[model samples]
Every structure is written in structure tokens, then in C-alpha cells.
Target chain A: MELKKPAMAGTTESSDVMITLRPNPEGGIVIDLKSDVKALFGDAIEKTILEVLKEFQVENALVNVVDKGALDFVIRARMQCAVCRAAEIQFDWGKEDAHGK
Target chain B: MANELMRTSLYAGGTSPVKMIQAGFYNEDCLVYDLEDSVSAGEKDAARFLVYNAVKYQRPAGKYILIRVNGIYSQELDEDLEAAVRAQPDAIRIPKVEYAEEVKRIDEKVTAIEQKAGLPVGGVKFWCNIESYLGVLSAQQIATASPRVVAMALGAEDFTASMSAQRTKPGWEIFYARNAILMACRAAGISAQDAVFSDINDPEGLKKDLEMTRALGFDGKTCVHPRQIDAVNGCFTPSPKEIRNAQRVLEALEEAARNHTGVCVLDGGMVDKPMELRARTTLAKAAAAGIKVGGVK
Candidate 1:
């Protein structure tokens, strides 16, 4: 269960944002997201998405999201599962490792 | 079975001191305030008095009271039942019901008590705690015992101890037990409640378990803390999308029935009886949440 810890995902809120995150062998990560998601979701979806990613300990990753009338519940469920898959949910991406560790 | 909204119940009587803090705090769902644990063996009499008084007239809206008396065969349990029948709670919760005969045995007592009280002979339902080795093995028989039986459950801690399972949280290894109880309950036309997560402080863990329980079609869950009420409410409440999905399914099904078709397709799939049962549950959640899910039958 050894996952290389070199990945990153940046957050964006414009409509048409694509969220994608994965491992890059070169030691960093790529984050790609379209900008239109914010327009589609407004405040609730944005808050849920951010909370889901960080709660599942997704750090050092790339993300791309395409919003098509998705709500906060949908975003949260999807992002939580995706982050679980990406990070194995094995680390504390929320705070400094030692304090959380 | 009711063909309309039935009140799904959440259980809250613990073997230790536990209580729900307010009215329908778990979305004002059904509450079974425990007399067994809240009162000491010395104070069991007083505890039953308090619970009976609560049940008699003061139960809040959206809350129904059931007394989790001591296990059905205990001497203390016999005393608790006598007091409970005098006050007349909704259902008698018999812990660790391992056999069909246990239902018959408890039924005899309930019948005698109901007869003596002359309380309109409601038959006061009998259900099982399918929580031990024998309980799981004989779930189907126990569930089918009598028409008065309404549900089945696996007391996770006791069942886990019987299985020698090693998990930090309560439900980690008991998903099979849960499903077994659920299947047998459905087969016998009854509801199933998932066991309590004993750690009251772990709201996240509680919420996660209750969410999974709801996803798996459990009508309700047992709880040991009032703080867990909000978590259970959040986990079990239907989102707008779920209600909309239920609405769509109901409409499609009604159309198909008009055409004399047994199945209807919704969201690129066929909506059949099983899916209808699930949709009905979603509808119940919407109803419980005070959101109108139209076309519910």
C-alpha cells in the first residue's frame, strides 16, 4: 500500500472547470479544471466541493471539473469518492503531518 | 405493507445511561427512551415510572415511545413488561431474541397482560433481536414467527463478540449480519434497525454508519447518544435530487401501470418492484424531512 506522495490539485470556480488529479512520476502533480462550475453551483456546491476534497485528505494532485447543473450533494459525494480513490485517504492533507499525525 | 407512509422508528434505549435530548431531535423520528439503563437496578421501579409517565401523555410530536425492557425472560424483564403494559408503550423491545419460540413465549406474556388490562387488544407487536450466533442462523424462522412481529435487528456488539470480530468501530465487520437481518425482515414483511454505534463522541463515525445503513435500506438505526441525532438526521434525510428521482420513478411507474406494464424505465433503467420499494423509502425520507414528495402512495 505504498503510494508515491507527489500529486497536487488546484481549485477553480469559474464555469466549465474540469477537476482532475493523479500521480505524476516527475515528482509534482497536474490540476486542470474548467471555470464554469462556480456559475452552475453558486455558493453551496462550491463549499461542499472544497470541504469534500480536503476532508478526504487529497493533497498534491491535479483536478478538472465540468459542471452541468450538478448540486452540492452530488459534488460532495463524487469528490469524496474520487479523493478516496486518489489518496487512498491515507494522509492528513488537512493540517501539518506531525500535529495531525 | 401499509401502502402509504408508515412511521419508521429510531431506537434509543441503551444498556447504559442514554437519552435523546429533545423532540424529534433526530428529525423528530421515533424515540425508544430506555428504562433499563437509565435506572439503577435499585431504581428500576422509579425509572419505569418516569418512562411510563412520558409515554402516557407527554410524548412530543414525531416521537413514539417504546420501552426496551430487560431481555424478555429475565425476572427484571418480567417486572419491566408489567410496568410497560400498564402504561402501554407502542412495542416491546426484546433483546437477543434467538429463536421463534422466544417470540411465542413473549407473545404469551403480552397477550396475558393485554387481556388483563382490556386495552382494545392491539396485540402489541413482537420482534426479534437477531444479534447472537443462534439469532443470525435462525433469522428467517424468527421473523416469520407471528404476524405481530414487525422487525429484526443485530445487536452489533454482542454479535461481534460471538463472531470474535476485531474492528475498532462497531459496524465494520457486521455488514453481512445487517444484510441478513434485512433480507429476512423483508421476506417476512417487517422493518429492520441497524445496531447502535456505542461511541457517542464519534459523530463522524456515527453519521457514516447511519448513512450506510440508510443506503442499504434500513428503516432506522439504534443510537446511544443524543449528539448522534443530528448525524442520523443528516444521514437519513433525502436530498432534493433524491425526492425528484422518487417523483420521476413514481410517475413512470404509474404510467406503465396504466398501460398494464409491470415495470417502468427511469433514468435509463427499468423501475421495477424492488426499485419501487427503494423509491418508497426515499419518499418516506422526504416525508419525514417535511419536504413534499408528490405522488407517494
Candidate 2:
């Protein structure tokens, strides 16, 4: 299910997450995301993780991904983070602390 | 790869040890079964449970038990790993280790499971199959991240597809990936295993390929069929001469210990260090082969 759909019962917007990815020169990829809540629904989360992997172009590279919360914006940010990590380019996306700049 | 460290390992290809046993492969020592591939799509859960139950009992002949879980990135991977944690086979095989983070994720998952299961943690080992192109790329980081990792393996069939080198032998086409992975495993102090030779009928071909793999730095090869085990065993097992050398090393070391000398010289150099390890491992392997050694057989 799309993270942005109306919050299902017992669902919290804060529980959703979005990921960004980028290239890393270490012959791998990296990921960044926002997961305000730690409600890891196991299998459900795997669907999204796999999707993000598609963009990383998983060739000769290492990947690092971080999670925040459920936000479409967060997903984009995660992708961006992955790119930076894969490229060995570091960017701050901590929502404000020298990141998100 | 003949110069590569040789270890004997077996595969079940996602089947239960029982199935392997029923098929006559499990009774042989040094055999292992996979919990991830080969099983029908629907039977994974049941097969996993069966494997777990089987682990509660001793495997056929002190066989080295290994469970290959689905790629950790899969939707069911976490669950599969969790099931295995409680089962605690000899080792947990992480399929498609595409990056360092995946290995870290596996390490963390295994740790949490060990703690939650109330099992004294830290004994389960990792067997990472560097199958995909991405897996090969991150092979170094992945192999070294987990302290529990005992070895890394190649998944040529899938990797061939990924690299579009399908059905081609001259693996040197992916020579860089192969060398890099082998080097990584060596740097990490773990065994590097090779995947199965699919053509079961071509025993000669299989033997030839293994010679290359052994030369390339693989400790052992994974087998898809039971018939292939003999060749794998033959390739990896310590030869009579090597065993004799190991026994010699052990005896020399023992005499030094008996003399109360912390260490002694051997082969015209400091034989203290390598001699001890080689001696013990030799003893262990000899024991595995039913040969008795001083104080350990």
C-alpha cells in the first residue's frame, strides 16, 4: 500500500517512511530515509526496500540506507541519500542538523 | 584455485536435511542443506519448520549443518532468518549478500534472535553467497562485516545471468569479480567456497573445474546433486602427504610444549605460530575422517 493513502485504523502518518538512493564509488549504493516511527511491519517494509534497490542500479558498489518515517518526501530524501552514500558523497539529511541543507 | 584453502561443504539447495537424508546425501559427513532455494514456492514455511525440528536432533553423521535463507532483502527474509535463529543450525547462509549493510542487517538480526531465543549467542556462523553482480561488488565489505562469518561462496549460475556470461565456462570472463571475492574472503580470514558444477553427468568436467576453483582460492564447492559430493570431497580433503605434514607439525609442537618452551623453531624459521594452528586443524580434519590423533582423534 502507498504510504500516503489515508492512515488506516491504528495507522499513524508518523509511522510511514520514504527512502532516497544514490551512487557510491566504493562499487556499491547507499540509501537514506525518514522513519519517525519504528513500526517495522516485516514483510510489508520489504516491498519498499526492494523497490528502492531498483534505482540504485546495484552494480559494483556498496549501499547504506537509513530510515525516518512515512513521508513521500522522505522517500525522495532516502533516494538522494542512497546516491550520496554510493558515490561516497556525504550529505546531511537529518531533517535540519547541517543536513536538509 | 587449487592453491585456495580447501574446505568440504555440502548443499541442500533450500531443501530440508531430511529430504537430503532420504535422498541418501545427509548420511554422509560434511553435507549441508539449504532452507532457501530449490524448495517449491509454497513449501518454504513448512520446510523451514521441518528443518528447525530436525536441528533439535543430531544430523546423520555429525554432518556440518548449514541453512541457506532467502535473500535478506526479500519480504519473507526476516521471518526466515528469525525461524533459523531459534533452530540454530551449524551456520546460517545469507543468500545474495549484495552489500555490507545486508551483512550487517543479518548480523543484527541474528544477534537479536539469539538474545530473544535465550540461546547463548555467538556460535552461529555466516555463509554469504556472493551470487549477484551487486553481491560480487560488495563482497569484501559483506564478508568482513560479520564476525560470525566463517566463509563466503560464489553463485555462478545466477551471477552468470547477472553478468550475461550465462552457460559460459571460462569464468575468467568475470575474473575480476572472482579474484576480488576470493581476495576478500582471504583478507577476512574466512573460507571462500565455489558453487556447484550443474552438469552432474560430466564428472571429468566437474573435477577439472574444481581444480581451477581450488587453485583460485576456494575452500570447497557447493553441490546441487548428491552424486557430485564425492568429487567435492576429493578435491577439498587433505591429501595423505598434507595430513602427514600436519601430524608432524603437531608432534613437533607438542614436544616443545612438553619441554616448557613457550614456542619452538621449525622448518628453519619460527614454526610456533602456523605450526600450532595447522596442527590443530589437521587434527580436527583427521578426526573428521575417523583417524585418531594424539589426545584427539
Best by DockQ: 2
TM-scores for all candidates: the values are 0.64, 0.60
Query: Candidate 1's residue-wise lDDT over A1-101, tens digit each?
Result: 21233332212322112235465555433444334445554566556565655555444455556555443333443454345445555222122211212
**What lDDT tens digits, residue by residue, belong to model 2 across residues B16-119?**
33344454243233445566777676545544544543443334444567777876766667767776766667688888788888788788888887776666
Candidate 2 per-residue lDDT, tens place, A1-101, comes to 11211111111223223223333445543333224343564334444455544443344323323343433322332333334433443222121211112
Runs in model 2 lying further than 4 Å from the true structure: A1-101, B1-6, B13-18, B23-30, B241-297
TM-score of 1: 0.64
Task: Predict model 2's lDDT versus the native.
Answer: 0.60
Q: How many backbone clashes does candidate 1 have?
A: 32
Residue-level lDDT of model 1, residues B51-140, one tens digit each, is: 554554345454555667777566677656665765566567778888899887777777776776665565566546776877988898
DockQ of each: 0.01, 0.01
